[model samples]
Structure formats: C-alpha cells, structure tokens
Target chain A: MDWNCTLTEERLSDYLEGSLLPGEAAAFSAHASGCVQCTQLVAQVKMLVSRMQQAPPVEEPRHLAGRILDATLGPREREHSGSGMFAWLPSIWQPRFAMGLVTVAASILIIFHASATAGGKTALNPVNMFRAANRQVHLAYAHGAKFVNGLRVVYEIQSRLTSQPETMSEPISEPARAPNAEPRPGQPAQPPASEQRQKSQSIPHSGRRHTHGASELAALSIISREDLTNGAIRSIL
Target chain B: MRRHTRRVYNLCYRFTGNAASSEDLSQEVFLRIYRTLPSYRPEQGAFPTWLTSVTRNLLVDHYRRTRRDRLTDSIEDAMPQLEEKHSPARTPDRLAQASELSAQLQRGLARLSPELREAVILRDLQGLDYAEVQKVLQVPEGTVKSRINRGRIELARVLEEMGLRPA
Candidate 1:
C-alpha cells in the first residue's frame, strides 16, 4: 500500500475507532492493504491501545460510590420524604426550612459581597456614589420642572384648539381695514382691523390641534415620557 | 441511587489516579449533576456521553482548584498492581504491573496539554467515538483526530522515557 500522503491522521484515527463512513473506510482499507506506512501506523496505534487497556485502574476507596450516590440522589429522596412528613406541619413550623433558606441566602450575599470586595468594588466606594449622583442628576434633567412646563404649554394649546373650533375657519374675503373703520363707499366690504388682528392670531390655533393619532399621542406622551424618563421615574418612586 | 453512585464512583476512580481525591471529586460531581438535573437535555446526546462530559469537567475543575495535589507526588511509591474487591477482575501481579503502567500512562497523560489530554481520554479511556468527541470538545473532527494522534505519539515517547514500551 502506497500510504505516504493518502493516510491522513483523520482517516487513521477514524479507521482505528471504526467510526469512518463506509466510503472512507473502504478507501482506507484499500490503502492499508498495499500501504506499508499506513499498516505500520495502524500497528503502532494498536500496540498503544493494548498497553492502555492492560493498565489497571486506580483503586477506589470503600463507600466512595455510596457517598457519590448520596450526594447525587440524596436531595430528591429528602424532598420526597420531607414533603410527605412536613405537609401537615403548620406555617409556624416552617421556620426550620426558612432558617436554612435564610442561611443560604446570607451565604450567597456574603459570597457576592466578598467577590465585590475582591474586585475592589466595595458597595460604598466613591465611584459608586459618584455614579449614583450622576444618575440622579440625569433623572432630574429629564423629568424636572422644565419638563412639566413644556407639558403645560402643550396642554394649554390643546385646550385652546378644542375649545375654539371656529379658529379653523377660512380667512375673510376682503382686505383688513383700521379697527372699527367702516368700508369705503367704493371699496369691497372688509373685516375691521381689530377682527382681522384677532383672526390672524387665531389662525395659528388650527395648526396646534391634535387631529392625528400621533399628535394625540404626543399630548399623552409628555406625561408618559416623563414617567419613563429617569428624573420622572425617580420622582414617582 | 446507590448502584448508580457506585458506578460513577468507579468511573471517577478509574479516571483519577488518586483514590481519596477521586472519592471526594466523585461526590462533588454527582452533587453538581443532581443540581443541574433540571437543565439536562437527553436529546442533546446520550445519557452516558453527557455524564462523561460532566464527570470530565468536574475532574478538570478539581485539578485546577487543587493544582498542588497531583498524583505525581506519591506515584512511584503507590503504583502497586492490585485491585480492590469491588473491581475483582484484576489479579495481583498483573494488577501491580498494570497499576505501574497506569501510573506511567497517567503521567504521560498529565504531561499532555489539557486539550490533547481531553481528546485522548475521551477517545481511548472512555471509548468515545470521534464524532462524540467532536461534539464534546466542540471542535471539528479533523482537529480531534490530529490531537488524538499527536497526543498518542507524545504519550508513547513519554512511556519510552519511563522505560515502558508502547506494547
């Protein structure tokens, strides 16, 4: 067998383990039949495997298995046994389990604290304090008096649009004249200057109306965003 | 539970050369297995495969945690060929020779890089197939085969140095 490059390590390992696919196995067998290098590698691998198999396992101590089993399966058996016996126990009698739970909780808390300490992140470190303060400042900026003022402006605009519907009507047909001025004899009739000024002021009213769902939502969102914003959330809490 | 525990204990003892540490680690392994039972998915692989992986992981962790406590310390003195009553297939002289050879084999194994050691142990000692080892190692099958071959070559060399031929 001309094994030189044809006998790859993968094929050899697979062949040794009998895990190669049929085609690859057939190919390998064909190569091994004629390939000296491949046959020698196989022989060497076999010798190594035989020696390993012959090596006796280390002695296990008595009751080691029992301990392992106990560790593995003890909890389930305890759960089953305890549940049956402790089912009738009053909530007052639950203190033992509660105490055990508390101890575990305390240990976990200690572990967390110790880990933090080891990482140089003690709970009361100045960095944590600084971060807390910075967070608080951000929250205040997002949901403070300034935000409320903006919401109030929006609410006022909404009220004006809703209460003054006529503010959205079409413009007057004639040009403006001075306040309280009557139309000239030859001139087209026109609104008095005062009415024209009022109309001009109210023209903007229609634009402020919350006609679309998004706009309505915009009105509600002032409060909601404030609630979600860090400052607002902190305030609410 | 007792029978299962015994089987696992024996398995661990076979893997770890030290009896005491193996006993302790075996218990710890089982405890972890029990705690993680809720997350075990048999569909992921065979139960034994998963179990072997778990056991292997525990042993590695134990080795790491107690790096100072190696079998090499008492190996020369302790590598007597004998089997305890439980695993009674072993005869005294063959057992003693096998134990010494096992020690040499373990030393050879210990000398290997952990990755190579893992591949060799999975393939040879635990008798896992290449595909199963690939799954266990989360590596391509080609890489697994190379590691195994390289690992075996190194082991044979080490064995030769220790005056034990591969055969």
Candidate 2:
C-alpha cells in the first residue's frame, strides 16, 4: 500500500476518531505502518492534541447568569461595559475628551436656542413689518380724511343738481367760468357767470326732473375705487 | 444555560486571558442568546453548536476591537527553552506541572491566528466533534479537519519551543 502524504494528513483525524470507512481505514493503517514520516507526524499531532485537550479552562464567575438575566429584564446595569460604545476601547481611553465633546455640543444647542428666541424678532423683521403697518395706517387715515371732505362737496353738488335739474342744461357748466360783462348780440340765452351761479345753486321748478337727477346721483355715490384705497376694509371688519 | 456558561466563560478566558473579559463575555453571550432565542431553529442544528457560533463571533469582534491595544510577540522568542527537570511522580508535583503547562499552552494559543486558534480550541480544548465544529465554523468538513491538523502542528511546535517535547 502506498501512503499519500496529503491524503494521510487530511484523513489522520478521521482515522484516529474511527470515522473512516472500514476499507479506507485498513488501507490507511497499512500505509501508516510502512511510512515512518506519516507515522511520526500522526504521533506528534496526537500528542499535541492531547496536551491541548488537557488544557485547563478558566473558571466562570458565579454571578454571571444573574447579571445577564437582570440586564435583559431591567435597565441594563453596567457590567464592565462589555458591549458599550466604549467597550471596544482599552482602559487608556480619555474620558475627559468625551466629556468635553458632550459639553460643547450641549452648550452649542443651548446658545443656539437662546439666540433664536432673542434674535428671531429682529432677524426675521426683514422689512420692519411693524413700521409698515404704522405707515399704512397713517396714509389710510390721511387719505380717508381728504376723501370724506371730497365726499361732502360731492354730496352738496349732487343735492343742488338734483333740486335744480330743469336748469341743469348748460347752466351747471356756466358757474365754473369767470363773470364777464360782454353779452352776445344774437345769443342772449346764456346767463352771466354770477347769475348762472346763483340760479344753479337754487332748486329747479320741475318735480319729475329733480327726481331723475336725485336717483342718478344716489346710484353714482354708492361706491368708488377711492373707498378701497382709503382702507374700506375697516368698514367690513 | 448553567451547563454551558462554564464553557463559554473558559473559551473567552482562553481567547482573552483575562478574568474580567471572561465574565463580561459570559454575561454578554447569555444576553445575546436570550435576544436571539426566536431565531434558533432546532431542526437546523443542535443548541450547543449554535451557542458556540455566537460565542466565536463575539470573540472575533472583541479581538478586532481590541487589536490596537494587543501586544505583538515573536512566536519563537515568546517562550524560552529550558532543561527538562525530572521530579518525583507525586500528586503535588503533577498538579504544579499541569498548572505550568496550562500557562504555556494558553500563551501559545494566543499566538495562533484567530481561525486556527478557534479550530484548535473548538476541536481539542472544547472537545467538540468535527461535525459540530463544522456547523459552528460554517465551513466544509475538509476545511475543518485541515485547520485542526494545522492548528495541532502549530500548537505542538509552540509546546516544543517551550521545552515540553514528547518522548
């Protein structure tokens, strides 16, 4: 029988353990009997394995099981920090650096929060929003006062026009011009400016003509774009 | 759990050679086992084999994490050669010799690569069968056997260096 060095080394453990097939075992035994090198190799490995097998195991702690159970059930109490974030590190790890880092991080957050609350008002007031509202209020009030005065004059003009509608044909237009002494020889129908003003200011004689003028003026006075510009939203509120 | 606690502890001790690390690793192993209880399928493999795999993985993680702190040593110069001293075959003498041998073996075990060391520890030290080792290692039977043989050879070389040559 021929001994294959590689094959013998590979199957030596199986052979020693009696796990090899009957025929293979017999053949290996025959080869090992003739091959001193393989035989010595087997003996040396066997002795090494025996010494290793006899190697004494270190004793386990009595409290390990209790500690494990307590850890799993309750909050994990530190036991040498076996699986902790710093567990991988040696005892030489500097706690001071870690503490400093945490302190810096916490301080940064606190300072950021303080600054945000304190500075947010001024920081976000990109356009002086409070001043904008104040300016808008002042303008609206000024425009509203002017608008009210203009409305009173409009009402007076409209009331006069409605009362004197029969005289409104070319008569209302004559008061805006200056009084003149010149009179046309063929066109004596137009009144002088002062007389035109006096006549227009008085009420007209026709009832149907006055009613028409009053209805038209009332319709025109209901709303105007100037009302919106003068903060008419205040009325809605 | 009690039956295997010693084994897990000793394996950790052998790997780390530290009492504190063994205790911590033992607690962590049981904790991990409890955490992973739902994932264990009995039909796939035996419980011990599964437990050993978990333990080996944790030790590997420990080794890598602490590699920066671990001291490197020359395997040849690690243990000095000495003249073999013959003592009377007394119980005390045998116990002392066993204790001394135990220390030398541990140092030797530490010097081996993690894979070979694990294979040797699982097969020879822990007394697990090849099949169980294969399951724990997740390697082919051939690989397990080769690793064991290689590990034994290296362990024998280390022991020889420590002046414990077999007649």
Candidate 3:
C-alpha cells in the first residue's frame, strides 16, 4: 500500500478510532512516523478529539425548560390571582380551603338550629341568641348531673347486693336453744326465736326499700334487685 | 423533557455560540417538535436521533437566516458577550477549568465553517457515534466520517492558532 500524507489525512479519524484495517493501520503508522506534518497533525487532532469528547457540555439557561414549556403549553394558568382587594378570594377554591369553609358553615348552621329550637322562635338578635345559649348550657348541665347520679346509684345498689350474700353466708346460730335462758348484765339479751325469724326476714325487705328510694331519687323509677344484677352484668359484658 | 432540552440547548449553544440565541433556538426547536410530534415515527429512528435531526435542521435554517446579520455584526463583539456570560468568576471552583476550556473551544468552534463545526460537535462534544451522526446529518456514512475527520483537524489547527493546547 502506498501510504502518503493525503491518505493519512483522509483516514485520520478512522485511525484514531482504531477502525482501520490492520494492514492500513500499519501502513498509516509507518507513513506518519516519518512525516513531520502528518505526525504533528495526528498528535494535535488526537488530543483535540479526546479533549472535546471529555468536555463538559455548556450549561443551558436555568429557565430554558420553563420557557420552552410556556411556549409549548401556552403560558400556564398564572396561579389564579385577581387584582382586587379580595385577592385571596381565588384561594378559597383550593380543596383544603373549601373543605375548611364547609366545616365552618356546618358548625354555624348547627349553632343556629340549636338556638332556634331552644329560644322557641328564630331571631337573629344578640340577646335572644345569648338567652338560648344560656338555656342550652343549663339543660346540658342538668342532663349530665342526672346521668352521673343514675350511674352512682346503680353502682351503690350493685355493691349492697353483692355484700348481702356474704352476710347471709356467715354461720347462723342454732335455733334449738333453751326457751328460757339466764340474762347476763353486761351482754345484750338475745331476741326470742320468733322475733329473730321476723328480724331476719325484715333485713332483705329493708335493703330492697333502701334501693327503691335511691332509684327513685336518681331515675324517678323503681329498680328491683334482679334488674340491677342484670344491668350490672350487661355493663360488664 | 429536561434531558431533551439540555441536548437541544447544548447543540444550539455550540452551533450559534450565543447563549440568548441558543435559548431562543432551543425553545423554537421544542415548539417545532411539539407541533410536528405526530409526524415523528419511531420506526424511522430513535427519539434522540430525531430530536438531534430537528435541532440540526433548525440550526442550519438559523445559520442561513442569520448569515447576513452575523456578517454585519462583528464576531469579536459576540465573543466578549459569550465570555461575559460564562465568566470564570461566575462558574464554581470545580468547573472553572472545564468551563475555561469549553469557552476556549467555543471560540475555536466559532471559527470553523458551519458544516465542519456541526460535524465536530455531533461527533466529539455531543458524543454521537458515526452512524447516529449520519442519521442526524441525513448524509452518507462516508461523508460523515470525512467531515468529522476534516473538522477535527481544522479545529485542532484553529485551537493551536489560538494558543490553546488541548490537554
């Protein structure tokens, strides 16, 4: 192969890229080793190609992407603003803001409904509103107190009923004791057998009466022992 | 979008050697792409190659359109503007050397003819392979290689003339 300066110049990139035929590459290298202009050209071009390949790309303008988008997509909706005193009015359309507005409106509606019902007539007057609010507060307090007293009475009945079994479980003295017994001065005299039987039967009735009185005070109704037990079991479950 | 924009912008900046014009040309290229997006067939080429082709066509049209203006306005006047835009003081410390070399290379690229400049940029700076460059240039592979070869030599000479020895 007749390798020359022209061949070297034409095949310069191929030689640099190592894509030339082995024979051609050998010939090209042989020619360039002896030729001063070819050697210098090869060195310089090789260095230039390497540096260019390694060169960092020029930084584009930061806003070029935004500008292109605006140009392509027609200048995005400008974030919904108005040139008026109520500039923030458009912000109310946001989902979060709208949700908050709905909650506030519902709360106001509830307040008005309660006031109208409590006052016996709907009026926007401040005095009427205040009076209705006061009445509502007093009614709520009364209901709360009533509820607390009912719970207290139910618990008290449950405790007394539970304690009655323990009292009855204690050992009862023998009923066959002598009819006539000597009385000691310091000790209280035992009641007669018939009296003792009457007293024992009267004890549970007295407890029932006490429970009835408490239930009347708390709930304005009578609650039997069985009902109180059922209520307590239901509360526990 | 960001990747495509950077590619287009880099091509424009390399070809035109002006940041403002590159930005405008990049937007224009994307706008053209947007309008003609339907016409783009994936079977024809990869999207990046198509994008590069669109950018190259626009650059060629831009070069032709601004030939008269470029002739009237001194290139020396434009060089300072580019330098001021990419001043070393403004660039971060790590990028200062690369930036300087890039600026110097830009000046050298400006001296080459449009065909040679585009060839060198696509092959070397843009890192397009010969086949891809051929596709983007819409030329035969032989012409792409020849042009890249000549462009590299011419650029080296130009850079040497400018006292910049590539490391």
Best by TM-score: 3
* Better-scoring candidate (TM-score), 2 or 3: 3
Residue-level lDDT tens digits of model 1 in A54-93: 5544545555655565665563333223356685545534
Deviation (Å) of A94 in candidate 3? 4.4
Interface RMSD of 3: 1.6
Model 1 root mean square deviation, Cα atoms:
25.6
Sorted into a CAPRI-style docking class, model 3 comes out as medium
Per-residue C-alpha lDDT of model 2 across residues B9-115, encoded as one tens digit per residue: 87887777655777788888888998999999999898888889999899999989877655553322343221112222223443354466666677677668888
Ranking by DockQ: 3, 2, 1
Clashing pairs in 3: none
Give the count of colliding residue pairs in each prediction.
Answer: 5, 2, 0
Q: What's the candidate order when arranged by decreasing lDDT?
A: 3, 2, 1
Measured with C-alpha atoms, the lDDT of residue A167 in candidate 3 is: 53
Instruction: Report lDDT (Cα) of residue B120, candidate 2.
Output: 86
Candidate 3: deviation at residue B144, Å? 1.4
Lowest summed-lDDT stretch of 10 residues in model 1 chain B? B77-86
Q: Taking the tens digit of each residue's C-alpha lDDT, what string does model 1 give over B63-163?
A: 67666644555543243322232234434543464455565576566566777777777777766788888877778977988998877766666666666
After best superposition, candidate 1 residue A16: deviation in angstroms?
A: 3.3
Q: Write the per-residue lDDT of candidate 2 for residues A129-230, one digit (tens) a residue.
A: 455556668998988887787666656555564555445433533333323325567767567778755754564544345456555644554334334424
The TM-score of candidate 1 is: 0.45
